[model samples]
Target: MIKVGIVGGTGYTGVELLRLLARHSGVKLQAVTSRKEAGMKVAEMYPSLRGWVDLAFSTPEDARLTECDVVFFATPNGIAMQQTGELLDAGVKVIDLAADYRIKDLSEWSKWYGMQHASPDLVEEAVYGLPEINRAAIRDARLIANPGCYPTAVQLGFLPLIEAGVIDAGSLIADCKSGVSGAGRKAEVGALFAEAGDNFKAYGVAGHRHLPEIRQGLTRIAGVDVGLTFVPHLTPLIRGIHATLYAKITQDVDLQALFEQRYLGEQFVDVLPAGSHPETRSVRGANVCRIAVHRPQGGDTVVILSVIDNLVKGAAGQAVQNMNILFDLPEGTGLDIVPLLP
Candidate 1:
């Protein structure tokens, strides 16, 4: 079995990884690290894994992780930068669910993340872990920078249009809403039940950190510079991301024809059947990303609606998908579980 270690295992994304990896037939979860929860049983914190993962949370200094074949960094951004190089140098594969190695430009990463990158040189070598976009490179990579929740959904939704040059890159806008869990499992004033429950509001306006990451992805498809007005909203729900992307069409186009032709035969990314709308409830706990397209008359813009569970496809689930590719395993192995619909 492939031995796996997860750092920062006490967070929402780390626990989500444990939940999914517990059922993977070919994996042995060797270690999970959490400084605050060190010496505590993981199952105690999350009863959902009572009988599955019996390991205790340890500190990052634990020797058990160095022995594993692969390590997942589910820690905060700065935390992973300090340890990823050591793990990779030890011949262990690394996957970071943070912002440490996602952006190619170190200065840009530093500006948004509010700290100088500790391992700026390694940034170029870390593969972007969006399987649909960079699967080939991921297979040979020792470190994978798992795409962020918002970027994953937005990039996937708009990639087709950018590729086809059907929309003006300067006129792009992504209005995304994510569940509270996307902010992490911390006791911040903004994440309190009182602050989030029964309320919906936009927080990050023009300069959200995710803007650069999204632009980086669009640049790849457009083969040139791209810009976007990215606004994010915090929903009272616990786990999902809905991204509504709008862009001015450069020419008259058929929405159905564009989406259908672009996503044909693409696994895990589905373009809904004609005239159908997708919901976050339909994709919760699953790796699927459902998208629908529309081009209403009297408007020169086209709208692309996309939805995904922020924790699943947006985080842990996509990390597992990257792991599958790194090992030459079938793209969907151990991840074929369907979405748990309401």
Candidate 2:
């Protein structure tokens, strides 16, 4: 069995990882670290895992965390970079759910995250863990950097067009809306229900951190530097992301044929019928990305709509999928399940 350890085990992503990994056939829960919740029963903190995970939150230390074969860092940015090398040195593979290793350039990483990257040398070896695009790289990588929720939905929505050279990369604009949980489980006044509910307004329009990461992903697939105007907002609900992307098609492009042909054999990505719109609830709790295409009259712009559960496809579930690839296991071994809807 694959013994697994999780750092920063008290957050939303951390608990979601425990929820999936607890029932995972090939994994064994070994250690979970939390600085403040040390010596506390993990199940007590999140009663949802009372019977499944039988462990306590421990302090973050090299010796305690290095025991597992694979470790997941669900902490904030900069925390993973500090100990990634040490864990890798001790023969433990790592997958960071934070933004630590997402951006390639160290200067850019510093500029956006507002901290110096602790391990720039290992940046070359760290693979960006989006299973659909970088599966092979993730298989051989000892350290994987998972993408942000907004970036995941946005990138997957535009990848095919960009890859086929049908759209002009400079004119891409992403307008995304995410559920409240995407903000994490921190105690902040702005994230409270009163502030977020019955409210739909944009934040981080001036400059969001995910902007560079989105550009980096597009640049890799398009083989050119792509420009983006990304604006994200908070929805009242608790768990999903809906991304609407608009781009100018430079060439003669058959929208339906392009999407259908591109995702022919893709298991998790569902390209809906010609005019069908997919709702966020349709893909909740599933590792699925539902996409639709539209072309309005009198314009060369092609609009793409993509939806995914922010916590599942966007975070924990995708992390587990990356682990499956890194261990040479079936990509859908532990994630081939249906979405949970009300």
For 1-342, candidate 2 gives per-residue lDDT tens digits of 998999998988999899889888989898999989889999999999989999999888732778889999999888999999999999999999999999999899899999888899998889999887998889899999988999999999999999999999988999999999999999987789999889998999999999999999999999989989999988887899999999998888788899988888877889999988889999988888999999878389999999998888899989999999989887777787788767
Put down candidate 1 lDDT per residue, 123-200, tens digits, no spaces: 999999998889889999999999999999999999988888888998799999999999999899888999999999
Q: List the residue pairs that clash in candidate 1.
A: none
Q: Which segments of candidate 1 are over 4 A away from where they belong? A: none
Best by lDDT: 2
For each candidate in turn, the TM-score is 0.97, 0.97
lDDT of 2 at 299: 80
Provide the clashing-pair count of each candidate structure.
0, 0
Would you list the C-alpha lDDT of every candidate in the order shown?
0.90, 0.91
